[model samples]
Target chain A: MYRAQVRVRYFEKKAYDLFLQNLVKGTSHLAIGQEAIAAGVAAALRPDDYVFATYRGHAHAILRGAPMAAVLAELLGRQSGLMAGKGGSMHLTYAAGNFLGSYAIVGAHLTIANGAAWSARYRGTDQVAVAFFGDGATNIGAFHEALNLAATWKLPVLFICENNLYMEYTPIATVTAVARPAADRASAYGLAPIVVDGNDADAVYEVALAAVARARSGEGPSLVEAVTYRHGGHSRADPGKYRPDEEVAEWLAKDPLPRYRERLLASGANPAVLDRIEAEAHDEVEQASLAAQGAPLADPAELERQVFADGGATWRR
Target chain B: MATLTQVATRTVTYREAVALGLAQEMGRDPTVVLIGEDVAAAGGVFKATAGLLERFGPERVRDTPISEQAILGAAMGAAMTGLRPVAELMFADFLSVAHDIVANQVAKARYMTNGQLSVPLVVRFGNGAGLRFGAQHSQSVESWLMAVPGLKVVVPSTPADVVGLLAAAVRDDDPVMFLEEKALYPMNGEVPSGEHVDQLGVARVRRHGKDATIVSLGTMVHRSLEAAAQLATEGVECEVVDLRSLVPLDVTTVAASVTKTGRMFTVEENPRLCGWGAELASIIGEECFYDLDAPVRRITSPHVPVPAAGSLEDAMLPSAERVADVVRRALG
Candidate 1:
C-alpha cells in the first residue's frame, strides 16, 4: 500500500504538470504536497464508494482512477476531458469510478457527499462517500452544516479537509476565530476528529481506513484533517506574498512526496525501482498532455445540449 | 382517456400521497431512499413521511441535519453511487440553501458523465405563502430552479399528479425537483393505482374550454379550474392546462391550446415579474404568434414580498377573479 501511494503520487504530479503544459489560458492548483490524502482515501475506498472535491481536485481525480487523458483533457478544456470539457477544472467527473464531481464552489461538495451517503445507506450498500475540501472550507457555512448533518444522520461520509492553513491568502487564524486548530471544528459536530500529518502517506492512509470502515459499517461520518502546505501560491500568477519567506522554507523541509521518497530509498527499496515508477508515470502524463492538446472541442452549436433534463425549454414562441 | 377510477383513485392528502409514493417506491425498489431534515421522525413537519422511520428504520428513512445543501448534495452523492434518493427540502423557499447541490451536482452529474451515471434523485418540497409562515418560509422559488439546467421541475396540482410525478421521479433516470403547494396538502383527487409513470413534460388539459387557455400549475391549477367553471356560465369557455412539470415543458400542449383558442393567459401565485408565468408567456407568445388575436397576458401575484397578513395575502396573490379578468381582456 505504501509503495502504491508513491506511484500514485508520481502519477498525479506528472499528470498535473502535463495538464499545466497544455493550458491555453488560466491557472492550475497543483496537489504537489497533498498527494497522500488522495492516495490514502482512494486506497480505503471501494468502487461503489463516492468522492467529491473542489477546484483543486486534480490529485483526487487522478488517484480515483480517472484516465490521465480524461483529466488532462478537462484541465485543457478539451472535449475528451472527464466532463467533455463542459466542467473544466472544477467540475470534472468520472461517474464509473464513483467520482461524482469536482465543484468549483468552495465548501459546496460536502452537501453532495452527505446526500450520497444517505442514499447508499438506504440501498443497504456498504458504499461511503468521501468529501475533500481545503482547511479554508472549514470556515464556510456549508462545512459546518454538512458536518452537523452527517453526524446527525449518521451518513456514511468521510469529511477530509486538507488544511494547508490559508484560504486563498487569508490565513486560517484570521477567518476562524476558534482558539484551536480548525480541524477541531469536527468535534463540535460530535464527530470523532483525526488530525494527522498530511505529508505522511501512511498516516493519511491509516486515518482514511478507519473513517471509511466506520462509514461502511453504518456507524456515521468522521472528519480527518490532513495538515500540509502548498509549495506555490494559491493560484497561478499570485506569488504568495502573504506567507513569510521563513514559513515557506519551513514547509519546504516537510515536503511529503520527497520525504516519502527518501524513506523508501533508505529502507533499501531499490532507487532504480523508484526511478522506473517515476519514468512510467512521467511518460503516461506526457502522453496524456499530448492527447489533451489534440482532444476535440465541444461543438459550439451543441452548447445547449443536456443543460436541462429534457434539454432546453420549448414554448409556442 | 382511462376511466377516472380505474386510472388511480386514492383518497389521500397531498402530503400522504407524496409520502406513500416515496414509501412505495422505496419498498418496491431497494435503490430508493429518503434524505431530508426531519423526514425520518416527526414524519416531516407536514407529516407526509409519518411512520417511515419505524417501518424503514434510520438507514433508509434517513433524517439529515438542518442543512438543505447537505441534504440535496448527499442525495446527489447517493444517486451517483447508484442509489435512487428522494430528498426533502422541508420548504421550497429553503431550496436556496441547497441550490448548488441540486442545480450543479445532482442536475449535471449524468450529463457531465456522458450519461454514465443517472441521478435518479427527487428533491421534494412545499412552496406557497398561504401558511402564514412569514416571508422567509412562504416563497414559490420554483422559478429559480426552472432556470437552471439539468433539472426537471415538477409541480403537482392534484394528489394524483403528486403520486404520479413522484413515482416517475424516483423511477426515472434523471434529477427532478418536485414542488408541492403547501396550501393544497389536503386537497384530494383520484390517483389510478397501477402504472403510475406519467410522462413528466406533458401538461394536462384539465378543462377543455375553447375561448382561451389558462396555463397554471400547483395551487393555481385549482384556481384556474374554478375560474373556468365560473367563466363557462358567462359563455366565456376557458381551457385550463396543468403544467405538471416545468422543465420538460409540454409546450406542445400550450402551443396546441393557443393555436386553437387564438389567445393565452398564464396564472400563478408567484410574484408577477420574472415569474414562471413570464417564461410561459415568452414561450407562448413566441411560438403561437400568428394564431394569437391579442398579446398573451399573465395573471400573477403582485411583484412584492409576501405579505404576512391573511387579508393582504389574498389581495396580493392572484385569485380566480384575476384569472377571469385576464381571460376577459385576452378574449376581447
Candidate 2:
C-alpha cells in the first residue's frame, strides 16, 4: 500500500513536470493528494476485479497494475500508449488489467459499473465491479439511478466517492444539499453509510476489504465516501486560487505520503527499508517519464483505425 | 438445392417479430440478454417484447427502471465485458436523456480503446411519428444516430426484416441502434421458418422500374412503395428501395439504381433539416451527377415537432400522396 501510494505521488509529480515542459499535451486531472484511496482500494481488490474510474484516474490505473510508462505514453500521445494515443490523458483504458476505462463525462461510469457487476452475477461468477467518482457525482441523476438499480437488483458492485471537498473549482459543500453528499444518500438506497479517512491507507483498505467481501458474498452494493483532498487545481489550466491558503496549509500538513511514512516509522518499520522504497519509486517514475518521452508519436495513418470492429472507420463501402 | 417453394413461412406482426427476433438471438447465444423498462413482466409498453419474459425467464429478460442512462450504460458495460446485451430506450426521443452513454460511451468505447474493447450490443427503440403519443414519444431518430461515427443505425420496415436485422445487430461486433417504427408494429408480413439473419448495409429493391428510383427508410419505405404503385398507373415506372441500415449505408445499391433510372427521390419521415434523406441526396448528386436526368429530390416531413392531433400528425408525416406529388412534380 505504501509503495503504491509513493509511486502514485512520484508519477503525478512527473506528469506535472511533463505538462510544464509541454511533453504531455492536452489537459490532465492529477490525484496528487488522493493516492491513499486508490492504493488502499487496489490492495483490497483482486487482479480480475473490475475497476471503473473517472478522468482523474492515473493513480487508480497505475495502482491497478497499468505500467507507469504506458500511462505516461498515453498522456504523451505516443504510439506505445495504452490506447495507441487514440484516447488521450482523460480516457486511459487497460481492459486486460480489469481497469476498465476512465470516463471523462461525469457520473456515466457509475451505472456502467453496475452493468459489469450485473454481468458477473448473471454469469454466476464471484467477480465484483467497483466505480470511483467524486462527491459531485452523487448529485448527478446517473448516480441516483445507479444506486437505486443496484440496490433493487442486489448487484455485486461498490460505489466509492472520493469526496475531495471540491468539484472542479467550486467548493462541493456550497453546491451540495447534504453535508455528506454520498454517505448521506446511502440510506435512500438501503445501503450502510460508510465514510473513511481517505488520507489513511489502512483505514481505506479496511473499508474497501469489507465492501469487496460483501459484494463478492452477494450481499449487494456499498457506497463509501472517502474524505480526501486534491493538492493541485482541477486541471493544469487553473492555479487553484479559489482555495484559501489556510485550508491548503492544513491539508498539505496532513499529506498522505508523509503521514503514511510517519505511521510506518512509528509502527517500528526499518528506516532503511522505507528509504529504499521511496528511492525506488522516484527512480521508477523518472525511468517511466524518460521512456515515454523517447517513444515515437502515433502514426497519422492510424487515425482511422479501430473505429469499428472490422479494424476500419469505413461508414460506407 | 432447396427451392423457394420448399421453405415454410408464417405470417407475423412487426410487434411479434420483435420478440421473435430477441428470442432467436437469446436462444442461440447464452451471452445475449435483454434489459429495458417494463420489458420483463409487462412485456414492454408496446408489447413488442411480449412472451420474452416467459420464454427466457426473468434472468435474461430483465426489467429496468425508467432510467435510460442506466439501461444504456449497463448494456454498454455488459457488452464490453462479455454479454451481448440488447437495451431498449422505450421512446426514441428519450435517447436525448441518455445521449452521452450512446454517443460518448457505447459508440466510442471500441474506438477509444483502440480495438481492445468492442460493444456488441443493440439499442432498439420505438421510433417515428404516429399513435398520437405527441412529440416526446414519436420521432424518427435514425438521422440523429446516423451522424455519430461508431454507431450502426438500422430501421427495419417489415416483420421479416425485424427478425433478420435484430439477429445481425446482435451478432455484429459493434453498437447498433435498431429503430423499430412504432406505427408499423401491427403491420404483418410473411417470415420464413428457421433462423433469419440479414447483412447490414444492404438495400432491398421492393419494386424494380426504369423511369425513376424512390429511396426510403423505416415507415417511409411503405409510403414510397405506395407512391411508386400510384406512379406505376401513370406510366412513371418508379422503383422503390428500402435502406435497412444507415451507418454501413448501401450507397452502392442506391447509386446503381439512380444510374439506371437517371432520377432519384428520397422519401423520409424525419423532419426536413439534416434528415437521412439529405445525406442520400448529396451522395447521389455526387456519385451519379452525369447519370442523373433531373436533380435529386427529398420528400420529407416539414421542420416542426410532431403535433398531438391525429389530422396534424398525419399532415406532419410524409404520406404516399405527398411523396407521389413531390416525385411527379420533380420528374416533370
Candidate 3:
C-alpha cells in the first residue's frame, strides 16, 4: 500500500514537472494527496474487477496496474501511449488492466459502472464494478439515477466518493445540502452509509473489502465516502488559491505518504526496506518520464482510425 | 429489396413488427437484453413492445425508472463489456435529457479508447409527429444523430424493414440509433416470417420511375410513394427511394436514380434546418451536379416545433400533395 501511494506521488510530481516543461499538452487533473483512497480500494480489488474513474484518475489507473511508462506516454501524447495519444491524461483507458475507463464527463460513468455490474450479474460472474468520483458528482442526476437503478436491481457495484471538501474552486459544504455528500444520500437508496478516512490507507482498504464482499455476494451496491483532499490544483491551470491557507496546511500535515511511513516505522517495519521502496518508486517514475519523453509522436494518419468497430472512421460508404 | 432473402411472409403492423423484431433477436442471442420505462409487463407506453416481458422474462426484459441517463449509460456500459443491449428511450424528444450519453459516451467511446472497446448496443426510440401529443412528445430527431460520427442512424420505413433492419442493428458491432416512426406504428405491411435480417446502408427503391427521383425516410417514404402515385396520373412517373439508414447512407442508389431521372426531390419530416435532406441535397449537388436537368428540391417541415393540433401539423409537415407539387414545379 505504501509503495503504491509513493509511486502515484512520484508519477504525479513528474507529470507536474513535465507540464511545467510544456511537454504534456492539454489539461490534466492530478490526484497527489488522494492516493490512499485509490491505492487502498485497488488493493482490495481483484485484477479482473472492473474500475471506472473520473478525470482525476491517474492514481486510480496506476494503482489498477496500468504501466506507469505508458500512462506518462499518454499524457505526453506519444505513439506508444496507453491509447495511442487518442485519449490524453483525462481519458486514460487500459481495458486489459480492467481499468475500464477514466471518463471526463462528470457523473456519467456511475451509470456506466452499473451497466458493467449488470453485465457481471447477467453472466453469472462475481466480478464487482467500482466507480470512483468526487463529492461534486453525488449531486448530479446521473449519480442519483445510477444509485437508484443499482439499488433497485441489486447490481454488484460500489460507488466510492472522494469527498475532498471542494467542488473545483468552491467548498462542497457550501453548495451541498447535507454535510456528507455521498454518505448522506445512501439512505435514500436503502444502503448503509459508509464514510472512511481517506488519509488512512488501512481504513479505506477495510471499508473497500467489506463493500466488495457485499457486492460480490449480490447484496446490491454500497456508497463509500472517503474524506480526502487534493494537494495540488484541480487542473494544471489553477493554483487552488480558493482554498483557505489554514485548511491547506491542515490537510498537508495529514499527508498519507509520510504519515504511512511513520506508522510503519513505529510498527517495527525495517527502515532499509521502506527506504528501498521509496527509492525504487522514485527511480521508476524517473525512468518512466525519460521513456515517455523519448517516444515519438503518434502518426498523423491515426486521427481517422478506430471511430467504429471496423477500425475505421467511415460513417458512409 | 436485393439484400432480403425469399421466405414466408405475413402482414403485420409496424408496432407488431417492433415486438416481433425484438423477440427474434432475443430468441437468437441470449445476450440481447431490453430495458426502458414501461417496456416490460406494461408492454410499452406506445404498445410497441407488447409481449416482450412475458416472452423474455423480467431478467432480460426489465423495466427501469424514468431515468434516460441511466438507461443509455447502462446500455452503453453493457455494450462495452459483453452484453448486447437494446435500450428504448421511450420518446425521441427525451433524447435531449440524455444527449451526452449518445453523443459523447456511446458515440466516442470506441474512438477515445483507440479501439480498446466497442459499444455494441442499439438505442431504439419513438420518433416523429402525428399523434397530436404536442411539441414535447413529437419529433423526428434523426438529423440530431446523423451529425455525430461513430453512430449508425437507422430509420426504417416499412414493417418488414423494421424487423430486418433492427436485426442488423442488433448484430452490428457499433452503436446504432434505431428511430421508429410513431405515425407509422399502426400502418400494416407485409413482413417475412421466420428469420429476417437486412443490410444497414442499402436503400430500397420502393417505386421505380424515370421522370424524377424522390428520396425519403421514415414516414415520409410512404408519403413520397403516395406523391409518386399521384404524379403518375399527371403524366409524371417519379422514382421513390427509401433511405432506411442515414449514417451509412446508400448514396449509390439515390445517385443512380437521380442521374437517370435528371431531377431529384427530398421529402423529409424533420425541421428544415440541418435536416437529413440537407446533407442529401448537398451530396447530390456535389456528386451529381452535371447529371441534373433541374435544381434539387426538398419538401420538409418548416423550421418550427410540431404543434398539437392535427390541422397545424398536417399543414406544417411535408404531405404527399406538397411533394408532388414541388416535383412538378421543379421538373417544369
**Pairs in clash, predicted candidate 3:** none
Give all TM-scores, in the order shown: 0.92, 0.99, 0.99
Against the native complex, each candidate's DockQ, computed on alpha carbons, is 0.51, 0.86, 0.85
- Which is better, 2 or 3, measured by DockQ? 2
Best lDDT among the predictions, by candidate number: 3
- What would you estimate as the lDDT of candidate 2? 0.92
Candidate 1 stretches greater than 4 Å from native? A1-22, A46-48, A216-219, A308-317, B1-10, B193-195, B330-332
C-alpha root-mean-square deviation, each candidate: 2.8, 1.2, 1.1
Give the DockQ (C-alpha) for candidate 1: 0.51
| Residue lDDT tens for model 1, B1-332 | 22355453657788788877776787798777786778887899888889888988776787766777767767776777667878889888888777777776677766665555667788888888787777788898878888777777889888777877788878776788888899999887666766465667788999997888889988988889988998998899888999888877788888899899988888888887788888878877777789998888888888888878889888877788888877776665
Worst 10 residues of 1 chain B by lDDT: B1-10
Off by over 4 Å in 3: B1-6
Against the reference, the lDDT scores of all candidates come to 0.78, 0.92, 0.93
Candidate 2 — which pairs collide? none
lDDT tens per residue, model 2, B170-240: 99999999999999999999887888888888998999999999999988899899999999898899889
Error of 1 at A228 (Å): 0.8
